[model samples]
Target chain A: MHTEAGPKRPTTPVQKGLQAIPLIINVISANFQLNQFSSLTLLEFALDSSVLLLVGGNRGRCVWATPMNNIIAYLFKSSLGKKYIMAVTGCCLFLFVIGHMVGNLQVFLGPEAINRYGHFLQSNPELIWPARIGLLVFVGLHFWSAMQITLENRAARPVAYANSKPVAASYASRTMVMGGLIVVSFIIYHLLHFTFQCKAINLTGQDFVGFTDPNNHHDIFKMIVVGFNQPLVAGFYLLSMGLLCLHLSHGLSSMFQSLGWKNDAYRPIIDCGAKVVATVIFIGYSSIPVAILVFKFGKEALK
Target chain B: MNLTLKVWRQKNGQTEGHFETYPARDIIEDMSFLEMLDVVNEGLISSGKDPIAFDSDCREGICGMCSLVINGIPHGGHAGTATCQLHMRRFKDGETITIEPWRAKAFPIIKDVATNRSAFDRIIQAGGFVSVNTGGTPDGNALPISKEVSDRAMDAAACIGCGACVAACKNASAMLFVAAKVSHLNLLPQGEPEKHRRALAMVTQMDKEGFGSCTVTGSCEAVCPKEIKLTFIAKLNRDFGVAALLGK
Candidate 1:
């Protein structure tokens, strides 16, 4: 402790206690962490110690969380594996969205388009299940990589500041996670409503009077017609579609960028490509419910 | 110009927040964005109200202290300009601006517009640097850094550590930010010694940080204040691939 002041820097009880702990304990715990580490963690601890030793009290808080500062000074030696995993997983999700939109486009080809497509998929459930599993793995990897990125961003800023101004970020991009969560909920419910025939969204004839013919085998397309006809259900579907569109809007081009699809002038073209893709996917999936209303439950049917 | 500012007000690190409206009148449009805030703060102090809290130091935009999500855009929607460097001319007369903090699960709001960006430090700590330090700050001219390498390195180095990349990304992805950090250093001959090691460490740390995955939209670069190139991101991928497949 420094003692050359009007008010002497006294060793308080807390400081005294902290100082009494053996440096060996710190080293032992750090070593235990190192053993489980994927790479040498000594850099972070060592950097923290050196910064502490060099700058001491004043600059201490500013850099305490920046473990990146002491990283071995080159990135090629440090972070390549995670980058590849991120790019690969990102590409997978991007491709899946495109495939999903294509499958969804069947609805626009008319009921036979969707029903035949659904039937075809159902007949080949064994082949499709692996696709579903792939989707799960891709989504899982995407989430894992996302979580990793956020954590690194946090550690980059340690000292809490007093005043700040806003920066440039889009509503869709900023809320990608939130939109994703909403989309996830919608996906679960959508599967239940269409695939499993959960009968959750008032799919029966009671909700919309004329659709019932007890003798008819419950048709999936018919179920969809009933679902979207209800204002509340239809509204949810529309909203979900909007969210999905937003997700695709940012998600598509980002995948290209992460996968390294860029040219100075053509970059904007790729961006436009993503926008078009999102738009097509949005219009295609959304047309299903609207089609049901147009073809099945017309203005006369409601009366 | 007179403006109605809807500022998100949070008391501390642990609190739910809401938008509080305030009037900012007779503001000079040519002032740096933070200067406008100072005028409002001065008004608040004169009226005996607690001044609005924010973060800034080098108003020149080098330190990356000012992180503001203005009207849903980080750094007020300007490309390659930090909040400190942003001028108020971007706004028009009688504009109703909604100013808030960076909204990400990873970046937690502390007070007013400030949020915890510590996740960035952690990701960088996780493995954002090289492993070749023998205690020599080599002379700038010592290493024969090629023009292409220097150019690419400069592009990556342009990342000011602003969280705009994260805020700008839809999934709250730090890939662009992390990739830039990794690629900037990894592209040069100076970075060659620790290349593989750097890729592995940074990537692992990124996973540990709870950020969402990169779906690969250029939104991070699109909204980037520095306009950091996507090439760095590609370079990051290339390096990561090498580390995963070819790195010893």
Candidate 2:
């Protein structure tokens, strides 16, 4: 659509298609001279138009023509923005944990049920790998943001108060970092125990329980049964589950507040909901080990 | 009440400071905290010693000039009273009370128990006002603001710029203070015209002031003399999100 014959002007079909869009055209004409149109300028122009569209009802032209997308992107660089990122990523991880627990709870149904579920997950590498990658990224963002916030908070109070005391914050809130560290360590150990099936460093020797089903899939039910049968392994899992409870208890409610979803009427309910979810996840995950060891519920599934 | 006072003694912003003990003798229970300090300073001046320096204005606790952290709690850990309103009756006779100034990088100690709080003023300068022309007063009923909205705005406007929120925050965050200003104006109809720009400018200035980020520990609300709610911080976050997305 450009009348100019310059090298930097829009020449691609994408640019031509973008020119056909009315909002982009309005933004381009409003923000730039016709002769100044370029591919980069068109992209910037589209971005500004989309921001206006998203916020709804343009009051007038933006005074500072600096791309608001850049400023909005710049928000994450600030400490408060880091908190927003942490809250968003924490929400993602929280959902994944609940989903993972629900999927694992199928073991209570029977060996065939749990193994079929495992096979269903392993058979679709395409879907599972991307999900795994997304979970990893969320973990990285959550941990990185938490670390940055913690370091900044530590620096904020260089000199410790001789008699510092917490008034409104809970014990879970105060011990978030400590509980988070334990949960991280537990996750690493869990992945090694189940996913990688690494035996060299296996402390409980549950790796000896590995079995293959008729479909040649790993017998996850047998592995879980044998694994939890060890008192040491069961005890460790229970302890880590407690730590996970603490971490999630605070992390869940704090995520809502950080995301600005809290209000006076619903805050107590949200807080109570967080506690319930954490408790349920704790019971759901720890129940498998408890049943395997205490009641031998999955003994028939073992080889 | 005879009391032992261990008060922070700072020379200036550049120098290190420490606590110095002084015996406050025969102090009465009815005396306000600042007035008790006044008595102690009078005795020190009579004895040819430099008097302890502290800040207080409108000792009735309205101006928010009294900034003190008593025994590791901002505003002496009182529920809804400023340091000036805190009375000696709160302490038992012969009790040892430790007092210090508001501690934050943004609020450097100017002297004993007095820090420069101009950082707050700078944040306020950065678009904390409606860009309206000075003119004849409009009728109060012309705007037609709902009582709920007006009351909320007034509640936010109740912030006295005390800087106690900053002192109480574990991160030394000023989010509550900035949120109070932003919500007070943004909730009103007059502030609607400049809402986006105002949120952006004020939050940018707050970050530049070297105050740490808010993690919503709720201590600021707990120690606020005016009882400003943490909900304002959430409202500020919502505004900043919308403003940042919309751009200025």
Best by lDDT: 2
Candidate 1 per-residue lDDT, tens place, A54-99, comes to 4332321333433333334223123333334555776777677668
Off by over 4 Å in 1: A1-117, A136-166, A206-227, A260-266, A295-303, B1-150, B157-181, B202-227
Tens digits of per-residue lDDT for model 1, B1-248: 88998888889877767778899988998898899999999999999987888888889988777888787777877767888888888899899888877766777777888878888888777654555558778676877878977887787888888888777655566778888888877777767787877776776676556565554545677778788876666666656655655533
Candidate 2 Cα misplacement greater than 4 A, ranges = A1-72, A206-209, A300-303
Whole-model lDDT, model 1: 0.66
Positional deviation of B178 in candidate 2, in angstroms? Answer: 1.1
lDDT of 2 at B39: 99
Candidate 1 docking classification = incorrect
Best-matching candidate per TM-score: 2
Residue A300, model 1, lDDT: 31
